[model samples]
Target: MIIQAYNFLASWQLFPEKGEYQSGNRPKSGYYRINASDDKSRLNIEHTWVTLENDAFNATFSIIPDGELHDFENAVLADQFKASIADTSNLEISFYKNDRETLHVLHQITPNGLLKITQTGTAPAGEQFTNIEIYHKQMSVLPYAAAVSGAVIRPTEEGMIRHKALTAMEEQTNMQMDQIRRQIELLALQAREIVSRKELSMLIYNARLNFSPVIGQVYYLYEKKTGDHQVSMISPREWGNGSGPFKTFVAKVKLLADHTWVEVE
Candidate 1:
């Protein structure tokens, strides 16, 4: 019987044949092409190879007795068989001849494209075997097309990568903007300091002048205890007007530096 199998993990279609077989419904052997789906991820096999015949094989596999027509009633295989086929792997097949007799076959694929088959006899009704199951594990079906020879890439995975890249770019932009704002604030502070220095220099220059002093010259003045005042051309304002018998002068002076007058002398 023609047997066809599918490997979901590798996305491969396999045809297992032993010898030449013929049926009225079988087609001539040729290259069959399947077109990709709209997303170019899934392949759609043509309709000519979709149906099952006495000789043709597809995703479904069945067994029939010798020298008989298609017997759908006594088929012992499951509706679907799940198996993993790699370069080198092993598989077990069991067949029952009667209620008291059974046969077990172990098929191994070698690295050099040879199948090693081992046969053994087992007791009938030994143990009831169920399906295969693994604990605490789950497999996700990929929504995108995966190449048979390379790593699998999912659409959600690509989206996550893009999201990370955008987040990093946004953070970098924010950092640059903060740096620019800080630079502007620093420049504004320096400008305020410069203006304050200019104003302090102007105050010092003004304090150095007497009532009739020159616009840019430094001088000193003194006020007597009797309400009379004295003006001096030199600093420290030590010369006082002695209009009264006892007179004392308040010492007030200005200094000069950097071509400007400062009220310290």
Candidate 2:
């Protein structure tokens, strides 16, 4: 996915000859502001404000950056300072990870297409920030469409098998997560108001550990204060092992729909 963010302030510039303030470049008397937008979220106009005097603005916005974005800014381009790229007039942002496009942002060819924000700058300490600023005079609107032609399609035996396994894994994981959540809720209810922090922590931890026990895994737990010294927790795959201590313990959960056990293994 190719993902990018572009922010611009709509402002009218005054020349030295037509100057209104002593600075000549930016007169305090003129009225100027910008309206910016993007995917992921919308900015409330009432919440958006720009400090004309500081040539800075604050607004609400969001972007879904590609996995490559982390690599681009952090790894390959680490040494480049934000000031060096602060003057970009326009930005063409594309995000891809492992050869798949995840997001794409194309700036319109309007006055707003002049500069892009790819650097970090200090702002007033208390402002909640979410977007970057860009400077441009013209922006061109690009046709927005999602492309999936490059995605790999599985057709071979191994590929089909792998796809089936992944589908099964996803379903199993979802089921396991739900079952674990319910178990945790029940255990929390039972352990509520426990005076000891250590006891509560152990209860929660054991509940989580048993929430989704693997098929072949054997879990061991013990406490010096408890009368029962040790416990051997086993899954269905370990059924062949001879029975040992039948301690007060929770069992691991099995999430696969194909399982026939009355309770999760």
Candidate 3:
């Protein structure tokens, strides 16, 4: 189509396709993920990052010869590849391969409007960017779109992983906080129980005890008309309507060997 200008990133897998071997420690192609020790993991990452970058340099078909063609870089590279040319063209059998560092080759416009590859540089780093003219040419944006799939898709997938990790970390922190809260609540309850037990023991001990209270024995406590407190073996239920000087039923309790009193139901 008639091209004005365009630009795009690329995408490529660091892992290999099915049946692809990782024979030489260098992953065949694409991303590499392995569950191993730290040293081995680091090595794999180093290998993948380096080789992936190598592929990216080759797959990065948008490296126009010079900055002047920068605006139309997408247009220029798009015309050279087919819709199915997803990675560095060399990897596919339908095209040629160059193991050296080269993102894109030079091209010239023929009389018929086809852009021809005239300088697929020979050096390991490929040729220098020679100033060129790329004013009017028919190019397809669809092909360029496919060429940049590697640079475009990989980051998004990686971002998804980071996002999930963040979410998991946040959930873990929340659980920790919840556990701490539960512990605090339990401790507060225990503290209140201890205070209640001490107050009960003091009240029962100070009250008028007509006879010695035995350990592990049940008893009753009451407030007398003279405002004096009393401890007795008689239960509140047994204190018929108006038997003793009981002005108020205090609480039912039991005596422990430690001389402490515990409220009974």
Candidate 4:
């Protein structure tokens, strides 16, 4: 069976290191590793974000595994059961999977001793894993006073910042001008009348020749004479004015590599 999507729910405990104490003098730093599994096999799972709490870190992974059906289980388990490390302040946790580092989270304890976390990494795409590892390093905490001092304006730095800002503004203006130019060109094409059958066909093929057509775009059009259908390039002239907007009275066709349209179901 072809699987379009997969959904899973898993919960596991984060055990402390062997002989590590968890009392008033709790361990300042530690890590946890969890795996995604099925009944008899492990799934290849990839994720971003490694959260850390006072006692445990809970995670939920809903992912689309890539690879052959037979290896899905092992892939998920192997990929998920990687290494994690905590820094001295107990504020950050980094996860490593598949021999590569992935997911970094910085957390802080609230006044009530609750964990508050912020994560930076490649987010899940369509709930799928694009890469086996996704994470970010080079994170730090700067005091508010240090930040304020760094933001203080120096004459030389002010000039550089102004120059960069002006450059960005100019680039944005140029992009807007280019968009306006394309719009004008499209409007000109739409104003022109179709002169001949060959010209109309060419217009349909080269969507740029007429604003009403889009080249390399798929469209379903019906042929009246043969009751055949075609997946045509989006050309308003060819398929726009058919027998009503939606009607089923033709065989379906697909464009082939040799520029031929073949009938399909």
Candidate 5:
């Protein structure tokens, strides 16, 4: 065979076996529990090895009722035990009894999954008291196991999603109400302008007139008496000297060719 620039495969080997693609040494840590089954803290593993397969096995184990929560207590277990065993079908756990270190009553999500506590004593796991952070007020003692059962104070994924949905709905409703209020205010302003124009048109039409009013001519409206109104050719500025025909100036208007009264700018 011709050699490549870097390397070359000169010949094919004669073999009857299939090639092994990968070959490397891996740590067998899971078997440690099975080998040390006789030991007290061997963690009570059965003959089954499926749980330890491909597992890191670096995970440590600890019991409940510790006065101070260490690394294994906080990392591996919840603060309180709900004593939930309903979903134990999917859990991968193995435990042995140690009154000192073994948590007979477990409420934690282990690295493999849920905990399976095996008690070696006659006491029913409930008698064990866990580390409930206690503070004495008057006449109290340390390590008081107050068993209260109701519901776990844990926020769920569905609850968080519902909260966000309600918040968005509230914001949307407020915006719609503000838009409706603005529309109502605009309608009120338009109504007021219409009423003012109608009153002005009525005054000019009812005023006394001896001559025919010309189209496109500006005229001033004034009050003849306290209640009576009139139209005049003289503007308010020109009425500065001896203008007694009308007293109070009302508005300025222009006559349209259509015989309809229109106000001047």
Candidate 6:
């Protein structure tokens, strides 16, 4: 019975109930309709007192007994109507009495917790149908209907959760990259400042010695073998474990094709 209650409540929430009557047929404003023109929108019933004028009685009709999907099944109703919100609003109920029959109450919210009241002429007076069905939007088959009504195709227990996690990770990665870029720029500036001969020699011998901790220094000078000028910097952590092993930078400038000077700082 809870399933029935849940199904009925869900249907009432999803489908529109009767509002005020328009002309003699169209429902009033604020109703759920798959497709309604400016003149006609389906009505959703949240309160008991809704004016059912015009052809409001059409909602009172019972469904004829059918195979799998009767009015009770959302998917069945959707499929029988070709799964169209626009088209289903115009459809009447299709049911059968041979197996079971049901009639839906149009205006009144019945005590049965029924989305709409169901009347089965074939059932015993005290017997009530207990089967309730739950259905999800068929994305592939009912894309247009889902879009028009803003229906979730299939809700997952973890889809939203996973998406949030991935978003957070991406944000963290961007922050780390930004920090590294800043450090790189700082190192470049330090290298440019190590232009003096004394500073360059200290850097090459101490920082680049592989046994020193004098890091965060820059150096540059001429090199004989490579015959090219170079500038570089190093961090304390990059070369040595402590201050004794001074981590340093070295750069060499070429005086001639074969002559070079080393700078350390």
Worst 10 residues of 2 by lDDT: 142-151
Best by lDDT: 3
Q: Each model's C-alpha lDDT? A: 0.34, 0.31, 0.41, 0.31, 0.37, 0.28
- Provide the RMSD of all predictions against the true structure, rounded to 1 decimal: 26.8, 23.6, 21.2, 21.6, 28.0, 21.0
Better of 1 and 3 by TM-score: 3
Quality of model 5 by C-alpha lDDT: 0.37
Clashes per candidate, residues 3 or more apart or on different chains:
0, 27, 14, 9, 2, 46
Ranking by lDDT: 3, 5, 1, 2, 4, 6
What is the descending TM-score order?
Answer: 3, 5, 1, 2, 6, 4
How do the residues 170-239 of candidate 6 rate in per-residue lDDT, one tens digit apiece?
4677688889999999998766654453454443344223232233333332222333322333333443
For candidate 1, write residues 3-82 as lDDT tens digits: 12121112111122321222122222211222334543333322112113212222222222122322222234222212
What is the TM-score (0 to 1) of candidate 2? 0.20
Error in Å for residue 145 of model 4: 35
Model 3, runs deviating above 4 Å: 1-155, 241-243
lDDT of 5 by residue, 1-265 (tens): 0111001001111111211111111222111011122322222211100111332212223222212232333322333221212232211222222313333332222354222222221223444432211111111111111111111223235433433453355457768878998999999987875666666677778886656789888888788865677778888789775446666777788776766666777
lDDT of candidate model 4 versus the reference: 0.31
- Clashing pairs for model 5 are 65-130, 65-131
Candidate 5 segments exceeding 4 Å error: 1-156, 210-218, 241-244, 253-265
Q: Which digits, one per residue and each the tens of the lDDT, describe model 3 over residues 1-265? A: 1011111111112323222221222322322111222332110111122233333212222222212222222332232322111222111111123322223423333365322222222233443432211212212111111111121123334433443453366467768988999999999999998789899998877889989889899988899888888998887667674336688888889888877888988
lDDT for each residue of candidate 2 in 106-201, tens digit (9 for 90 to 100): 333245334322322122353322232333232222111111111121124443343345436646776898899999998887565333434433
* Candidate 2 Cα deviation (angstroms), residue 100: 20
